[model samples]
Target: MRDIKIIWDFRGPAALKTAEHHAIHLKEYAANCAIEYTTIDIQTFNEFYTIAFIVVKEKDMLSVRDALKPHRAEVYIKKRRD
Candidate 1:
């Protein structure tokens, strides 16, 4: 199994409510997929993007990525190296 880092960028006003909304939605998404996920803030020129670190079994990579397609507009994936 390999660890993967999934980054989701939310574009909009950089308000507290916006950030909270992203966190809440992501939390639900992760829980539903049963994937271990953690989130952090990434600074950007216009808005703040949320970067989620998801650790999943290598064999389940495609499945998990597909399941998260709803957020593709702001999502990205990468493998973690030791």
Candidate 2:
């Protein structure tokens, strides 16, 4: 299996709020998709907002990425062998 980090930037000042919103949505979506092992992070720097997710496999990671694409911009995904 491989590990993957899926990330995307949020365009606004409300980074924390946006992250929290997406976290909630992600939780529900993950449960429905049967992906149990993942971590979601909300990062902010000055005027930048980003959401990051680490998962154990590319298949699972891509599933989450697809789910978040509509609400996120500049999506980036990284993968590593486990």
Candidate 3:
């Protein structure tokens, strides 16, 4: 299975905690799922921002997205109006 990454970015005073909380939600969502996903956080630019991500099989991308949606962290491909 090909590995794919999905991330949720958090910013502000409680960014780190928020990212961790978000990771927990993702883990819970993946429980009993067919995909193998790992949750991790990256501290970007000091400690004011943290990004939590899941590394999962490419085929499980949709499932991952579902878990990420509640955080409004799902990445969307926007079509240009031009």
Cα RMSDs, all models: 5.3, 4.9, 7.6
- Candidates arranged by TM-score, highest first: 3, 2, 1
Candidate 2 residues lying further than 4 Å off, grouped into runs, are: 52-56, 70-82
Among residues 3 or more apart in sequence or in different chains, the pairs in candidate 1 whose N, CA or C atoms overlap within 3 Å are: none
Ranking by lDDT: 3, 2, 1
TM-score of each candidate structure, all chains considered together? 0.46, 0.63, 0.67
Tens-digit lDDT string for candidate 1 (3-81): 4444455555654456556556667766776766434333344444433334445555567667665343233355489
lDDT of each candidate versus the true structure: 0.51, 0.60, 0.65
Cα lDDT tens digits for candidate 2, 1-82: 6566555556677766776777677667777778865465666665655564434365566566676664433323544789
Tell me which of candidates 1 and 3 scores higher on lDDT: 3
Write down the TM-score for model 3.
0.67
Residue runs of model 1 more than 4 Å from their true location after superposition: 15-19, 37-53, 70-82
Please estimate how well model 3 matches the true structure, expressed as its whole-model Cα lDDT: 0.65
TM-score: model 1 vs. ground truth: 0.46
Better of 1 and 2 by lDDT: 2
Over 4 Å off in model 3, which ranges?
32-34, 38-45, 70-82
- Tell me the lDDT of model 2 at 78: 49
- The CA lDDT at 21 in model 2 is 78
